[model samples]
Target: MSLDALTFRPATLADTDAVVALVESAYRGDSGRRGWTTESDLLDGRRTGADEIHAVLAKPQNMILLAELDDGSGPRLLACAHIAIEDGAGYFGMFSVDPGLQNGGIGKRVLAQAERVVREQWQTPTMRMTVINVREELIQYYVRRGYLRTGRFKPFPYGDARFGLPKRDDLSFEVLEKSL
Candidate 1:
């Protein structure tokens, strides 16, 4: 829970599988149900794929920021979030924290670091993200972090199983923004 013990760094291609696993574990399947952030009830299947991560890593301005802790062994990935410049603002997405570590302060620290990375490294003044509209609790978490709901909606990729297999017909994403 102490930020001092967490190491923040940009992930490399070598981290693709780890990143994918962390993401999937946090949001999909039975493993994800261990965390409050799990979308497993609303969707099934993978949250993200290796190919998608590879595409993101292939870009110069984009990065997957990793939060790691040594925990007596070598550092292990605890959380990750994807950041990129989109339409001149920081686009934050693919955020995931270990299911066992949720509700601790680790996610907040990682998010603050992500905002710093975007504001300082990318010189972006704002950060944006899309959250499923039905996830009111999750949206409130971001709201507490200073993000505002824009009332804009993006259709969930219903046909795209790569994103997830929708459990219902009402799934959609709402935009959230915070000025950095």
Candidate 2:
């Protein structure tokens, strides 16, 4: 779909199911394989669940930003990302775009809106996100969008079913930050 037909809005509890499905399609299992953003090779099982989405919605200063497209057939969820202000910086996570729409500039648009919201609404000077350290290509994609690698790392939540099952022992997260 064209970018002009897209709409950005804060996700509500009613959108939990669609958001979960969109995230799963972009990151886990066979369905995610259709997209370049799939993490299927590095992880297994579900990427996210309805309960987690519900928790995000119920929290203060947190929101799941959604991108919807109306192509005359009716509005359909296309992409989403979770954003929250914490420790004086905006945190971005749970990002996903429709597999069929990957590399078509939809993700970039969603990211721009997320950054705008953090900057304008939260009045934050910086935005931060963590990417799996092994995802060099994904990191490079963010680099092109002005995010810088901080060389800081965090251990992956091994044994945490909520995050996903790690396929390798070396899995870890590298923090990336950008000045807004």
Candidate 3:
């Protein structure tokens, strides 16, 4: 599909339900397992709920960009990229793509749009994100997308039930960055 068919914009409170469904389908449960993006082995339960999303939209430093695509079938939310500015740099997180479209070039297109927004709007020199240290495959995937590992690690929230119960003891996040 042409990139022109995708409209990128800041997500609103109204998009919460569809966004939640899209995220769950992309990262959790059996449906997520159909694609390489699933974190089913690492955690369970909801990813980001309506409340969390609303907070992001309310935050001055954060904005979640949703990618709505017009396929012949209908208006499909093909992907989402959550960008937050922290300590002067744009931090990209909670990104998800439709499982069936994983191998397609759509993800790169969506990411390109996100980076453009951050660089052009935030005017930041770098964009950063964290990946679970144990998820080497996912980390490598980001590496292939121009993100470089920084060797910076943050402890995963172990008791934060909102995030989910950890399946492994050594779970932590490795920081990655891409220069804008």
For all candidates in order, the CA lDDT equals 0.94, 0.94, 0.86
Predicted structure 3: lDDT: 0.86
lDDT tens string, model 2, 23-68? 9999998778998889999999788999999999999889999999
Residue 29, candidate 1: Cα error in Å is 1.4
Model 2 local distance difference test score: 0.94
The candidate with the higher TM-score, 1 or 3, is: 1
lDDT for 177 in candidate 2 is 99
Candidate 1 Cα deviation (angstroms), residue 42: 0.8
User: What is candidate 3's lDDT per residue for 1-180, written digit by digit as tens?
Assistant: 676787888888988888888888998999999889898898987777888888889999688888888777777798997898997888888889999888887778778887888899878889999998988988998899889999899999998977766778899999999998
lDDT of 1 by residue, 1-180 (tens): 466889999999899999999999999888899999999889988899899999999997899999999878799999999999998899999999999999989999989999999999889999999999999999999999999999999999998888899999999999999999
Off by over 4 Å in 3: 1-3, 72-74
Q: Could you list the CA RMSD of all candidates, in the order they appear? A: 0.9, 0.7, 1.4
| Highest-TM-score candidate | 2
lDDT (Cα) of model 1: 0.94
Count of backbone collisions in candidate 3: 0
